[model samples]
Target chain A: MLKNRTKIKVKGLNQERAINNLSKTIRIYNFSRKEHNISEFEVDYNNSKHIKKMLEGQGLEVVSLKSRGPAFFIRDFFKRGGLIAGVIFVLIFYILQYSFILKIEVWGGEASQCNLVKNFIEDNLDSKLKHNISTEELEILVRNNFDFVSSVSVAFVGQSIVVNLNPSLLPDEMGTGFSPLVSEYDGMITEINLIQGTLNCSVGDIVQKGDVLVYPYVTDSSGKVYEVEPKADITAQVWLSGQEIHYDYRILTYRTGKSKVQSQVLLGGLVIYSKTPDILFEDYECEVYTKQLTKNLLLPFKLKKTIYYEIETEEIIEPFEEVKEEIISKARQKALIFSDKNDIIIDEKYTLSEGGGCHIVDYVVTVSKNIGG
Target chain B: MFNFFNEIKNKASGIDYNLLNEYNIINLSGKLLYVEGHQGVTIINSDMVAFKIKKGRVVVEGKELVLSELTSNTLLLQGVIIKVEIF
Candidate 1:
């Protein structure tokens, strides 16, 4: 067993003489006397009583005799095992909490698909739970096992595992049975090439939305009608229009370089402490940012900072030509979203008008694209 | 008498005290004092401490002087050492 130690304060006017006498009587493990006449030293706990008696006999004061070191702690721990038992229980509880899987959640799949994934994981990876499981390995395994799963990700929320999967695109064989190729937009067919079905609309034929371009039903030579899913390559000249309206005079908010910052701490969704004050600026924008204290540990404590910036609005008038150009550019960009790379822009038209201090611009773009479905 | 013993010990160990400077007293920024190759500590008080070397005695005067460590021949003292006297 390690020897127990104690620190005793020796109070006297002559610290040197006291230290000298104490050193002669009892072994001083360590001693320090700083600026004051009082000095403190550590001695063996067993010899403390004799040292105290010796010091008192010499008309000196020995105060604050306290046991130190792990020896006393070990003795107390064995005497009352409740503290040690509680600590052991807490350690076991945390170990179990982090080790076992409490819940398994699956996302981004049909009910049946999710159930299949869950069952697969439980059957294949259940035995490996005794050891640490790598989420990257699990994700790769899941993605490789399911053909429909385009991507998979595995995440751990405390003891629960969440699996997210993305489904792949459907195959061509899953198309509607005996469905004809219909026009997706109102346009005139500019070119047509039929693979299996009879062409219903010829080139330069005006067609409406939902009109069939290629008929899936064909009449055989024996007066028998058969059905087949239509396949075709039909190009149509489609007219697309977009409009944008911009004000010639507008009020814009500008930062005035005046701002105030406030800090706060939230515990369990409640504000525990804050140094924030009520906003004094009438026209101001507030930006709120929050930082979590313990990440990935399920702690409900966070520090929040909010900054308010005072703003001033100014009215400015824009030139008609500049506003018109901006509106036309915006309208053209909007129309381009509907056209594809191979599509040809056959014609473009722009119209501009002014009313109510606003410049209104309308644009029409004619594109030749494959609009068959 | 101490020097005579040290000379005999150095000879037996094949060491030269003159070249080696047997006793080394280093003051670190007036905060710590490192004494190497010391014989022993003779007096220790709150204000001063004295160590016996081969040639003479080294007395360190300071406030709240603490003998941080003591080994067979080396001593480390830490405090606000104001003065160091050798006699």
Candidate 2:
């Protein structure tokens, strides 16, 4: 049985001691780990008395034996510093997160304005700064400089920044305290509603210039029954005819342009010039440019750019009227995109328009539409 | 010397004399000493014995003084005998 004894672990003695006495029935008890190895050594005394004489012959220093017991694993004990270091690591990790960003709150009159204020706070005051700053001071700095922000309140909770700002609160421009929306473009009226004011134009009635679509009424809706003295500004849409001109020039050349070989590495929305290789041009002139593609991890990969090179080659062929037809088709497509952007519904077919010196054809287009007044 | 032998004979006769005398070969200094049934060998350091079997003709060879106890199966040799050339 292993008891309260210490094990003197002789590092160099374990190897020879293991193979020396294989038959000796003895145990080397290691009290440190509470373990032991047992063996037996034979002493044949009945056959020859000389064996007994040799048993008491010489003396040699025996190495300390280890404890031979079943409970050998009790020696695995924790050191004092291990527990202390574990607690200290946890404490430091918690302090770092709590002492930096505790709380962040943003307030703006409009949600979009609040979002903008949040982004500004994140960019400027979210991270750890090597300075001792007060919440009141930051609030004063924000409120004084920003014209769009009417007021701002800043407070610190633990390690958080609580910021409240008025983003929707606009300064009163007129004494009436109402902002009006006028007609952005001239168009014919399709419908009208008197949501907040007396509408000037009725159904099928056309209105023009500076018509109010919604406003505060000076009188009630029931009182204006007989003599209509315009008590409210009216929002009306006036129809107008508008013309849009579009020019589309498509040089129908073969895909043979060769771009110059150029490579630029893009990192964090910034381009870094890395390498540029020359283009290989055969009998046909070609252009090739290579751009260095990079991942978010800032590793660069190869990217190839190709441009078809075209050269003027004279051929003994009869000229056909195919270029004019292709020009008209390209012009119509360009004119449609232009008309759609202006909210003008096209009614008439596209025809040729005046072009200066360029071979590009111009198409005249007209559209009629109703727009908000 | 006469008084010493008489004293030894009186002491030997006085005890319950077990006159069991045996002899064995001793390989000492490369010389084999043979003993008859009368020359009984007494091993001083009997624990210094090396071999077990002691009967018949035995051979022993070593560098150090290897002592062996003579039994009915083997013989005892006590000396720095280099080799035992059995005849």
Candidate 3:
């Protein structure tokens, strides 16, 4: 209701008298605001312009006259036609374009590869709406299609779905076309499931690391070489080794009779208060523990107890024959934890030696793992 | 208690209580003042405002006083209204 009313302000020596005069002329309106000797009021749209001219004729400066209602728009609609048309056109275009992916954009890569990817995506697109398609799935599909594609990312940029590609360096735009599968570890071939490559080794063939298990190009019976990106699954018996040393003698530290326990209240991990008593021991170690003191979730307060234990050190030596089995068992345990969980453990062996107050053990673990990349 | 005494005073003065809603004043928590049956605005300022009522002048004293609404016979006064006196 207030927005539809016309607002007017008049400046004069006596604003109160001016309001009285206006009220006498248009007796049905109400005054809204008055400041700095200027009074403002709302009048009907039909009387606004006439009232402004009437105030001016009375020698009162009409400060502002704003008539806001449906009548003003109807009188001046044709003057703003071009500006309104441009705004409407932009609104319509924005609504139609941003809701769908306009086109695929490749940021970086070989031109041939990018074109090839664009063609593939255009042919396989299920939907063009931004929410209907997943950019991560597109990235994975592009990476899978080309063996030389090092990295790729697909995201919606403005109205277009942009695909940023960083393909690995190849021989040419036509591409070397194929990649050979080589053994990543020295092992004997245990399994070979050739999906799409010529296998050079069979089961039980001993192979070394860097040995090519599949060739890049394949020869047909007509002796014509057709290059293809190689793909296969190979498993091998890989030997992994871990070495660890155990000492027969060690330095032992014990706490003396002197000790001190200091209490502290910690609020949100900050020390709010701590009982005073500086450390008296020259060489001491501190053991800290905390207890929850606040039951309310809003106040996170804990009571921390730091116990200072005065310590003294001494060296203890023992004969190697006394703890022989224990040292070997410890060495084996430490070495086994370093082995891979995915590897199928077949057999293990260890070599033991004695040196300066320590037992040194080297362990070799044999396992079956997928080695060819 | 104030409203009861004012009613008694108005009755003793022989004024009509509900006739045309004339010479009426409503104070809301000393923050807003509404007066009807006003003849004219005699004086207006941040601290004080006076209006011509039927029998005498009604003066409103406060801080940051403002006449929010005005008509031929009614007016709405707003701001921190400290006191309203009849002269």
Candidate 4:
């Protein structure tokens, strides 16, 4: 059976001596590689060690001996099949790891809150797939596990499973009484409109705290208007004057003519390339370059290249009064958005003080409205 | 001399160039010859089997021999190179 076995090259042995030492029926075979010198022979099982010792005595190195398996099988195993097998093994291993939630990415959440919930879920919930646990059971487990969570969905993604928890809903914006747009803080009424209710007070009326500017009940033109299902509760936001201390530190920039160059490298759809190598001069003060590389074969990875011209920034100090007026303008813009009304009337405007290491302008304004005084 | 080398090489089987250059001359006992470049001298004989070069010279180590080509760079010996040595 071993007569036609693949030959192993035995180095450092004389052919005549080796042939004499072996039985007459045994054939000595010679093969050479760039790496090793080999001599192979089909000897009786009893004489295997003897031949090995003989080769060793002659100082010939025996690297490896191949006896079983077809030659083509071993050859193909080394060539293409080796890489394929290794890839398959790695894929299986990753699938197993993902079968257990090795990683979880939470979106639609603030950074701090996301981290808090992540820690909570990781510490409290049992994230394993038990034999008795169904999808419903897992959802119940997660909902019962977390206090802030209202609903949960547990599902298998690829090899691993994921549990997505939706937090509980906030309280209704229209609370107990009639749905009214009340003043968030103490303020005089700004503008008023009896859209769906009666007017509690007219325009230019000076109203105090909790004064209802508009009522919920209304009468129609035909003198046969039905009573509004909502009660006659009144709600209005007073445009109260607020003194806000604001600090503004001004920065002035001076253009510089000098420029620098850098090099960048990109690979595999993502431009991990950040090294910019050369400086380009242009007459414009700012430059924008947009380059897009396809990432993951579908979506685009956008690289916004903004070249900031060399500029020297200088700090410009403004007097207290000038900055104060600018602060009031910004404050009024913010108030308009916050109140959703525009009838702003300045009742009192003044600057408290300034320059104690804190640069701030303080002022107050009062608004008049047609509401219950 | 050219014919001598050509004839001996033709007679020997598996006489590749690697083995031919590795041959060393042990004894130059019989013939006193001049060493010139190729085809300067020639050896003609029939009893010899093979030839081997020893220490940069062709040594006639076989049972009987004849010499023809004698040059400083190349020589021809019509005989078997039984053994070879460097020194």
Candidate 4 or 1, higher lDDT: 1
Best model per TM-score = 1
lDDT of every model, 2 decimals? 0.78, 0.43, 0.75, 0.47
Taking the true A–B contacts (Cα pairs closer than 8 Å), what share appears in each candidate?
A: 0.00, 0.00, 0.00, 0.00
Candidate 1, A1-373: lDDT as tens digits: 2668887887766554555555554556555553265666677887877877877866768767878778888778878878888989999989976787867788999999999998888776744353577789889888878867889999887777899999876555333357778898778898888776778889999898899888776667965455666788899989887888887778988989888889988888899888977778879998999999766566578899999999999998877776566679998888777788988999999888878888777888999989886
lDDT of 4 by residue, A116-198 (tens): 65565556446553333366865676566554567767665654345566776634321224443333345544455445555
What is candidate 4's fraction of native contacts? 0.00
Off by over 4 Å in 2: A1-276, A282-329, A338-346, A349-368, B1-87
TM-score of each: 0.33, 0.23, 0.29, 0.25
Q: Which residue runs of candidate 4 sit more than 4 Å off their true CA positions? A: A1-237, A240-292, A295-306, A317-346, A369-373, B1-87
Interface RMSD per candidate (angstroms): 9.9, 17.0, 10.7, 15.7
Ranking by lDDT: 1, 3, 4, 2
The ten-residue window of minimal lDDT in model 2 chain A covers A26-35
Question: Which 10-residue window of candidate 3 chain A scores lowest in summed lDDT?
Answer: A24-33
Candidate 2 lDDT by residue in tens digits, A1-373: 3333223232222322231221122222211211233212222222223322222232222234333223443433234567668878999988776667655677664777666666666666644531355677777677655646767888776776778886434423212434444444444555554434445455554445566544433354545212222233233332222233333332333434544545455544455445655545443454555655655455655455444454544333322234556666666666565344545444535444455423445554545443343
By summed lDDT, which 10 consecutive residues of candidate 3 chain B come out lowest? Answer: B13-22
Where does model 3 sit among the CAPRI classes? incorrect
